[model samples]
Target: MKKRGIGIAVGTHPAGLKGGGDPSQAQIRLKPDGTFDLLNGAVDIGQGCKTILRQLAADELDVPLENITHQNIDTDTGPMCTGTFASRVTFMDGNAVLAAAADLKKKIRDWAAEYFECSPADVEVANNKVFVKGVPEKSLSMAEVGAMVNWGGKFLVGTGAYTPGPGQQFDPETGKMTAIASLAFGCCVAEVEVDTETGVVDVLKLVQVFEVGKAMNRLLCKGQNNGGAMMGIGFGLTENVCPYYPTMDFAVQDLTDYVITTAADMPPVMVEDIVEVPHPNGPRGAKGYSEMTASLAGPAILNAIHNAIGVWITDYPATPERILKALEAAHA
Candidate 1:
């Protein structure tokens, strides 16, 4: 099936042209030299969106990813894009890249047909060639085809633009909140053991499952999940940034006192499973998967702790004192 249309937006904040003006854009040019230039506004913050998007484009255009050159994002040269947040860059900018590459592919096919004196259907883009199908010997390199088309002084350039949906406001009086767009659901089950005396929490295992419209890169997906799980541990036990003396001037200082999840604290992370319910607005049906992990981590760990020691503590961090207090209350 011919994959058409842009993917949906997946994040707390929807990116759209009208809303917040944070839509992402890109300019792509297929050169006659069998190479391409991609000008993207999205930044790569170790999430692997850069490599994944490039792979998607190469697969669609039948070009090797190595042949593509990525240009650094410069406000002057790149399109206006929002900063990387809420994990929206891959979905929004990825669509833009796909759209631009599709346009270039169509143009190349049309030009190739004219040059070969055959129907456009007779031409196929494979291994950097615009040639008649089944006749590899009579094929033209992408560079040659591009040169032929650009001989008329027209460059093969295409642009893609993507905007997310609007925001939904909460009802202050009703204490209700409505989603501006679609919601991605997820669940995680964790097994933990807490030392009632020391108040130290140890995660024995984590089983997480999420519905991320699609999985662009399984490796990247796992990374995001594991990272979020680690962060969630911190939120539950180590991230204790309390105000000092009820005054704003001082706060808990240093990582030594403010603990977070370390390698020793994390157990084997078992990815239970992931279901891909393609989003209407996502690129290839992918949705956000970072923050949700943290959301599930807190509740899952807390519940497990409660199950382990017949006590329920409302406060966070569950310091030794808090656990002991809860234990005393439970016995009393």
Candidate 2:
């Protein structure tokens, strides 16, 4: 006999390092060809940090996205970044990029003002052109400005760094600090089928929703959501490192002994829903949401298994042996 059940779980995630002091730095330089080089240390571990930062830079500098080239992180030459984790890259590093772009824009305006013998306040930089405000007749392309600036033995550069304010305040009694800069919320619903005879559980479908502050790129956000859902299912059903623990006699050591969820094991992602509630302090109101999804699916799947078999799985992976033992104990 087989039974089906549904389970749901909700969760929240914090962006940036806990207890504060997390910092990121960035630099921007105008090339002679009118392109801008954005240098930062936010590594892209498949989370699309590079694309997001470039987007932020393009917008902040008031230039076409194609005019911005995001330089890859280089330890020796690049700016400082406190590594990428805790969903902090988009928010923390993004701020640094914005700062650098703002500085660069100001420098360009000042230089353009000097060349036109006008006040810096009267110069406006937009769409790859610098022009005197309300005096459209006097304007110069950014490419021309860059060429002239470089040829005049001068450099046009901007630099910026960001830290989440000062150190967070901690509770004296509990030793807990106010650590989070932004919060992302998520909820997941899982449907599963359980086989009574073999103690096998199969996930049929998943519906996930998340409040990600802002979707800088909707397709990228959706990809992160779906990928995280798959990871959650794997943690609940298939991936395990220590098959035999506490005794430590026969631990699964290699790939052949270990089990993981594959494409064949993936369930349909029925709904990929995202809520865009802008954050006041985020980079264009964007927050970190990738890590939150990885956690939601496991508990939801466990709950669904309990609903199907009337037994709770206290451990991860919920291997067949454990499920059968739970069932037998319940029956007994």
Candidate 3:
């Protein structure tokens, strides 16, 4: 007999430490060609932080997207940033970039006004041009302003550093702690099919809903959701880093031994809903949601199996043998 099952789980893991003081820093530089550079310490592990940070820089500075070069190479030059983890890059690192952009924008506007012999308020930068308000005919190319600043023996550079708060040391005796700067939440539902005879389980559908503050990039959010769902499936079904028990030997040695779910293993149906609720301190009210749906997938899959087979399997991977044994014991 074939059976259908459904499982659900929630994730409330935070974006960073509660009241921790770890800071993320960024530096902004204006070049003579009206282009810009963003130097930060946050390493983008292909999670799109580079693109997201660059977007923040460009938007805040009122510069063209193509005018900014993202730089995060070495500690020797890159601004200091707390290592990327806990899904804090978007919220923490982003704030730093926002501040840097604001600072650089002010300096650029100042020079733009000087070149026009008007009050800074009279000039605005948009679409890569610094123009006088209500007079389209009078405009200065951003590159011209930069060239003037350079010839005047000045460079535009701004730095921003964000630290949530001074970390409070937890009371050793009471375990009391302060609140975190921000928190991200998500919910996931998994639908699965189980085979009674062979004890094989297949994930058919996965629906995820998340509170991301804002979608800095909609496509990036979707990619993160899908990627997290598949990884969650693997975590619940396969890809165990340490399979052996107390001996601590590597049961699955490497790629050949480890079995991670691939595209073929993805669920047939996947739905993602992104909720935008602006954060008070986050850059443009955006927060991190990269790993929010990941941890929930495994539990939801496990619960779905229980809903179908009516057998509670505690051990992970829930291989065919274990399922059979659990069925036998339940019937016994």
Candidate 4:
């Protein structure tokens, strides 16, 4: 009743962002209760930017992760940033946070030295405490230092700005384009069962491999990869915009008219592999690769169909009708 076929595909999505050299900004300020108020203009639209940025901020400040409060972006209150983009948040925005963290660290230590009545070189911060070198007992909690600075001393605030750099302008003569940032690689293998009579495809297994540079947050990484696969499945199977397109007269404008892949439609067997070949220009040796996570699945599924039925369904929604027609045409 079902014929099986296998297909493999490898692809890449350019790192950095869609457009390079965009500027971003981040600000960090200490709170009254020994916590931090981190402000970055990057918006999180279900991509886990808040969690990832919080981790970055916490690492840089030597503070407990729970002590940092990430605030949403406000143009009037927060620093300027390039905003979120297709592939730029993890690399570009993260770099800005790194810059801010570095500035904040330097400021904290400088002030800590002044308060400790020692040279800046003699002060070290660890476990949310600033102490003189070799004297762990002679220390002040981060909040105490913050209160001192905020009440009458210099405000404990730091800001950072980041831009990729002087990029080449587009040239009209010879039409040559300069190289953008490096790319992340995605590899996928799709195993499918094709029912010749009904012209339906049942995806049995999907194996994915990604070169992620580094996994920032493992949970978020899983979310992106798994969610991406579902999106790819819909793209390859039964998702379409205009129901019966060409004419457009019968366009049903409702969610009910659209066929999206669901949990029940997920492949029975899914395998994932992550490769960590850190990129040189990335933050914490990490590049954003979620943009390409689901990219190769569509092509892999199409290749699988060709292998299975010896026919090509060259339409958007590879529906059962299209598959049947392709099979009939191949026979003719």
- Give the candidate number with the greatest TM-score: 2
State the lDDT of candidate 2 residue by residue for 1-332, as single tens digits. Answer: 89999999999998888877899999999998788999999889899988899999999888888888888758568999988899999889988999999999999989998999999999999988999999988898888888888888889999999887766768989988777888999999999999988988889999999999998889889899888988898899878777877656667787776776678888864577899999998889998888997899999999999988889998998778888999999999
lDDT of each: 0.70, 0.88, 0.84, 0.81
What would the per-residue lDDT of candidate 1 be over residues 1-332, giving only the tens digit for each residue?
Answer: 11111111122323232233356777778776768888788778787767877876786688889988777557566876776776666777778788878877877778778878888888887787788888767698887876777776777787787766444445779867544233467777777777766666677777777777788887787887787778877776667787234664566777876778788777765554677888887777776555576667766777777877867767677676777788888889
Better of 1 and 4 by TM-score: 4
Per-residue alpha-carbon lDDT of model 3 for 1-332, expressed as tens digits?
Answer: 78899999888766666667878899999888878889999998878889999999989877778889999988567899877888888988999999998888777778777877789888887877888898888787879877877777999898888878877888889988776677778999999998888888889999988898888999999888888888889888776666665566656778866778888998899898888898887889987668776888988888999999999878777666677889889989
- Candidate 4 C-alpha lDDT tens digits along 1-332: 67889988898887554336677788889877678988988889888988888888888778888988888668567777667765677777677888888888888888877777788889887789878999877798988877777776477777887766645666778766554565788899999999999989999999888888887887788778888888887888888887576878777677677788889989999887788998887788778788787687788888899889888777666778888889888888
| TM-score (all chains, Cα) for each model | 0.81, 0.96, 0.93, 0.94
TM-score for candidate 2: 0.96
Q: Point out the worst 10-residue segment of candidate 1 by lDDT.
A: 1-10
Order the numbered candidates by TM-score, best leading.
2, 4, 3, 1
How many residue pairs clash in model 2? 0
Better of 1 and 3 by lDDT: 3
Q: Give the C-alpha lDDT of model 4.
A: 0.81
